[model samples]
Target: MDRRDYLARLAGVAGVGLAGCVTLPGSRVTGDDLPSVRNATTSNTSSPRPDGRLPRRGEVTLPVSRREMRSPLTRDHIPAIVDPVFGDDWDGLSLPDDSRAESTTLPGDAPVIGLTDGDRARAYPLRILDWHEIVNDTFGGPIAVTYCVLCGSSVVVDRVVGGSTTTFGVSGYLWRSDLVLYDRATESLWSQLLATAINGPLTGTELTIRPSSLTTWGAWSAEHPETDVLLPPPQSNTIRGREATFDYFIPKYRRDSPSVIGFGTDSNGLHPRSLVLGVAHGDAARAYPFETIRREGVVDDDVGGLPVVVTVAPGNTLVAYERRVERQTLHFSADGPSRLSAGATRWQRSTGAGVSGPQATHDLTRANDHPPMFWLGWSGFYPETSVYGEDAN
Candidate 1:
């Protein structure tokens, strides 16, 4: 079945009686239409002056030459969500469970990217994201929740530029099989994986990645029962006449045998399609594969010379955090799958919050997983990254 049909099938799993999915009307350009789009271009005159606003075009630096970028679709082929609407009662809606159940995949089991701001949990369903790649959300300050279905990359970033908040949109461009996003205000082209502007006026500027969890909606909402979910626009907006489908892409091809639009191969045996939680710190970056973490339960390791800990829940919700507390490095182990225990202190797996012990008020500094991104997506940008099981595997 096509992607839209797939989304519609999985969204049926939600137990709610009703409520949303936003899908843009435009369709991806066929291979034949690729030639119609222009190659990316830029004119660099001086060193990049990193700041909060877009500098004039031709007055700064570019980390990559324009030759590496190509426009596959015109702007808004998959539009960005500028004014996102949320519903607190979506969980209460009666979702199609047994009646329209999927024959292959589990119903309502699609991955939902979860984030909490000001103690309010929100879910951005991938079904909607497959159509609109960027959501410029203003939950707490300004942030952009982005997903590139091709690369299996979801990036939540601080959308503040040069002290002012801005929104982002899909550029309909592709680089290294990843999404290229452009800020609506300045029109600077940003790479979703690199989180850096590759062209336009704001080249070389990097976005601050925020913390989020990529997991099944059942798992996320079960933990955050009060979570608000993004609702899709009316069916009339979908140009393809595709119904309001919800859910994420299920990996079809193998990383061992690469596809035309995927990472070719890895001599290290890391498959491009492998699901992993990746962390980049200091001068080092590493990927913690789901298989390894699911088996080990808790992994205490060091990256970039700093101590780190990784925890995974039974539902595949994962979180990473700095293992040091006030300069003291503590080795962490599993207190079951969803909690961490290190001597007298304990932390919730979904969050680094100290739930029990004298440090209950202290919060562990959140570490990066890049939202359980795929191996091909993470490794493409961090080619020198180390694998967590290099020594064990």
Candidate 2:
């Protein structure tokens, strides 16, 4: 079956109901049209800045020279009107402390973006990110927390790029159904999935990805009770009320939604919608399927020539870490709640710290940049990725 028919059948089997039809306004060009579109230049005429300030467009000498844009999706494929501009520091950017965050009502199963820097931790609920796709906030330092509901990609990036701190806003654009963010400093457009600036000044600049956990609210709260949860921006009753009525976390939407866009079949034979945690080390990339990890509990594998262990703790919290200690690689297997064992060594899942054995005082290095994403989005960017259990299939 073709891609569309396969997804349609999958949705039917899963008993997914389609909502009201709404066509996003944009051109239907594909990757084949990217070459010609690359040659076309955006108008030099200055458009009113999102801040209402008039800055001369195309006048600033960007830090880098303009180069041919390289992406799986063409420029024309990106819709100009999919997202609405909320401008810089849009009204709802508020971060409340633990004491003040008690009033927020969130279900246990609600998905949240869990971030930790040193000892500081915070949870950015999807309910709030759905309304405000970009949250410019600081946790121990400056960072931009972003979520694209369209492609199911959640990324946390450092706000400082090239010595200067830059804030980001939703650029009201989509490339291959993924969110495109614009830096307010130079108005450079960035691809969220690719993590690189594609247009305007700073064309070649890339954002540094920080380690984050995308898991259930219950799991995060239980793991770190003192962590503050992001509440809806003050006086956002209308947006909060509408979000309450919408069930975006249903299994059908996550497992069989038609919003997924990809160029071809995954090199690995797993279903396109399969949830995978992608880990990139140097030039090597690998995807650990959620189905496999849930069953195995602990998986010891090598990616990019480094020994790593992918662990699924209680509450289904997924995390990856380098299993090397004192230059020796340790094999791991699920021992019990938040614990793993490598031979005689027992380690804690939350911190990857060895609890017992010769290396009891040692801690494993975390593969912090790894992000859990859908197979379609993961495979679309890393076509050479090897799925963990592809050989068995």
The TM-scores of all predictions, comma-separated, are 0.77, 0.70
Alpha-carbon lDDT of model 1: 0.67
Worst 10 residues of 2 by lDDT: 15-24
Q: State the C-alpha lDDT per candidate.
A: 0.67, 0.61
Candidate 1 residue-wise lDDT, 1-393, digit = tens:
432332233223210111011123244344555543244456443353477444432223355555665555667656567777777534333333332423323235667788898778998877667667778787777899898765678889999987888878877666655788888778777878777887766677778888787887788778888998776543213322334443223322232343323223244445556678888877798888887888888889888987888878645766788988878888888887677888888888887878898665678887784778767567666666788887765
lDDT (Cα, tens digit) per residue for candidate 2, span 70-153: 233322221221122222111343334423333334667777888887776788777657646677776666788887655467
Q: List residue ranges in candidate 2 displaced over 4 A.
A: 1-104, 235-269
Candidate with best lDDT: 1
Q: How close is candidate 2 to the true structure, as a TM-score?
A: 0.70
| Stretches of model 1 off by over 4 angstroms after superposition | 1-28, 36-40, 43-63, 89-108, 235-265
